[model samples]
Target: MKTFTSGWAFQKPDQNYFKKFIRLNNIAIDGIVYPKKILADIEGIPVLGFDDAHDIIQPDDLVLDVSTNPDLRKELEPFFAAKDIDCVSVPDYLDRLLSADQHDALLLPVAGIKASDIRKLKSAPIPDRFDAHFLDAESYEVASKLDGIFRHSQWQRLVEFDRDDPTGNVLFNVLLDLHARGLLKHLSA
Candidate 1:
């Protein structure tokens, strides 16, 4: 009965449909739609404002904080820690998940997973077209900061993050390789 409290992007309109869909599948998830920062339920797995989000997440839940502000983790970690919950900013989460020989992230599922012996959360979504939805000021800030990271990485060949990616797996994999080779800082830096 773990809840995947994803940090959703702003203005996502599928919360209602997603809540209904989860109810039909009996996944024990509540599609909490925050008016200030909408969360994505599908493969997009968008981000949301973490301040108010802690209220909705239950103990043992994992929150994906997508704010580009590096200080956000410092602020969130202690709060979630007090509540017995786990939290990770997007980049940090990916870096850890893709790390090898140094972490236990391999236990986590990549796309979908084997659930309840049969019902599966199949992996598929529209091409996301996230650039279209990233019209918010925060999105612009995140994009700008991450763009600087891409330009500054020592990956030998250019590593570009596809804003249109629905699942953000590109950034995750890149972060893993860069971190492994010691070519990048902690999280796709």
Candidate 2:
């Protein structure tokens, strides 16, 4: 069996219906594990810092950090669907599955969001549509900072990993898993 894991520090806890879907499909999950210092409580869901999640991922589990680019989550939707992968949000618990050594998985970083078009938006006019979008100021700040780092350091890391292991499709696999579970709403055209 193959499984993929992903989590977004910004993803609302109430929006975790995807968890039930993955369980119904019997997919393995790897939730993002973070150090205590970076942890924050968001409506009761434990959110981790992007750097912390990246630093602690296990090699054997397919890990995903969605803090970098929310759109990347959309990009990955179809791929996870075709592959029939399972998704998980936590990483430490995922280590338990690694002990079996019977499954294949991918580890994805939330770093890819750096490559997204958010930079373009800085100069672009704010969409009239967002007037009613209710974005909190703090969320905006965190996302802006994360995007900057992802474009620089995180993007470099992902490129290096891909260059070293071209056969691995961590990003694609996670996208597919999200798609399969119908959790990939952002990607819908």
Candidate 3:
């Protein structure tokens, strides 16, 4: 029932046969591909998977959105009312799930450093391979913008500071490096 609508659905496509079925032989299923139509049936409920966007839907599939898609809402409401399937708005769902503690859990906290430790922290060279792999200009921009505590929105804004780099992996790796170096602490509740 919990579906991510903001392209934040944590998923990796199964690199297997039926996935290939979509790629290789769409004609076999009347041109209905995995993402183009309902990808599969999950316990009698059709599951539609989308990342950037979806232009299609079947009556039986579960779809997630942000309530911003009025056209889709109008189209999908009959199915939802009949309990034939579910249509969920992720932002609304997130509002229901998020509390102050839940909100705080998502922040990355910068560790407090003493003046004495500043030199050590600076002198401690980042490993060359790690630097080469993760520390690009984008990553540096992200890292430099981290505060004592910050949320994903702040981090996202920092990532998009200079240019529009929507690829989150580089920013993730940069944060991961800070975590590895004991400079960043992720709070959980």
Candidate 4:
């Protein structure tokens, strides 16, 4: 499930667009309006209080930061980062989802998301290296070399022979796909 917290930063967000975005992605998100100012009457999502949000949000939950205020960013960024909560601007999220076509829902909106409340646009950051949290050193070596990304189906088709590799052939398929995309080089036999 996705989670969000709307802060004092929001001026006039497109509530209707937000609703359609959630529905199109079928994201089961719980949101809260802090300072009790944002009176967005989201139909399915419940408006939670600060205390409720603190208790409910865990690691991986995203905190929406629509503010361009440096002071607000300084104060909030560390707090959320310490708690392992991801903070993202709504615009960035929408762009990534749309561009990647990563929506999990069967039905999607034909139109694009409108960012009426956004002040300054935030650009997506390119990763310098892969985070080897769940991967071993050997796996990390290959993963770290992946300088680009492609659709899984495209990669899968490139390695079509492994579809029946009973063991799932996950790492091999991924490595092979990266190699095919020219994202991996100097691979040892």
Q: Candidate 2, residues 1-189: lDDT per residue as tens digits?
A: 223234444354422433432454455433433333344644344444435544444344454433345664654444434344333433322333333323323222342322123334334554342354437754554455544433333232223322543433566677778987889967642
Alpha-carbon shift of residue 100 in model 4 (angstroms): 3.0
Model 3 lDDT per residue over 36-128, tens place: 234454323344444212434444443444233465556445534444445454333323323332323322212342222332333554434
Candidate 4 is scored at a TM of 0.40
Per-model TM-score on C-alpha atoms: 0.28, 0.23, 0.25, 0.40
Worst 10 residues of 2 by lDDT: 106-115
Is 2 or 4 the stronger prediction by lDDT? 4
Question: Could you tell me the lDDT of residue 148 within candidate 3?
Answer: 11
Best model per TM-score: 4
Question: Could you tell me how far off, in angstroms, the CA of residue 120 lies in candidate 2 after the best superposition?
Answer: 42
lDDT of candidate model 1 versus the reference: 0.43
lDDT, model 4, position 125: 38
Q: Any idea how many clashes model 1 has? A: 8
Assess the local accuracy of residue 112 in candidate 4 as a C-alpha lDDT between 0 and 100.
Answer: 33
- Determine which window of 10 residues in candidate 1 has minimal summed lDDT: 113-122
- Model 1 misses residue 101 by how many Å? 21
lDDT of each: 0.43, 0.41, 0.36, 0.49
Residues 129-151 of candidate 4 have per-residue lDDT tens digits of: 45535355545544433212121
Candidates ranked, most accurate by TM-score first = 4, 1, 3, 2
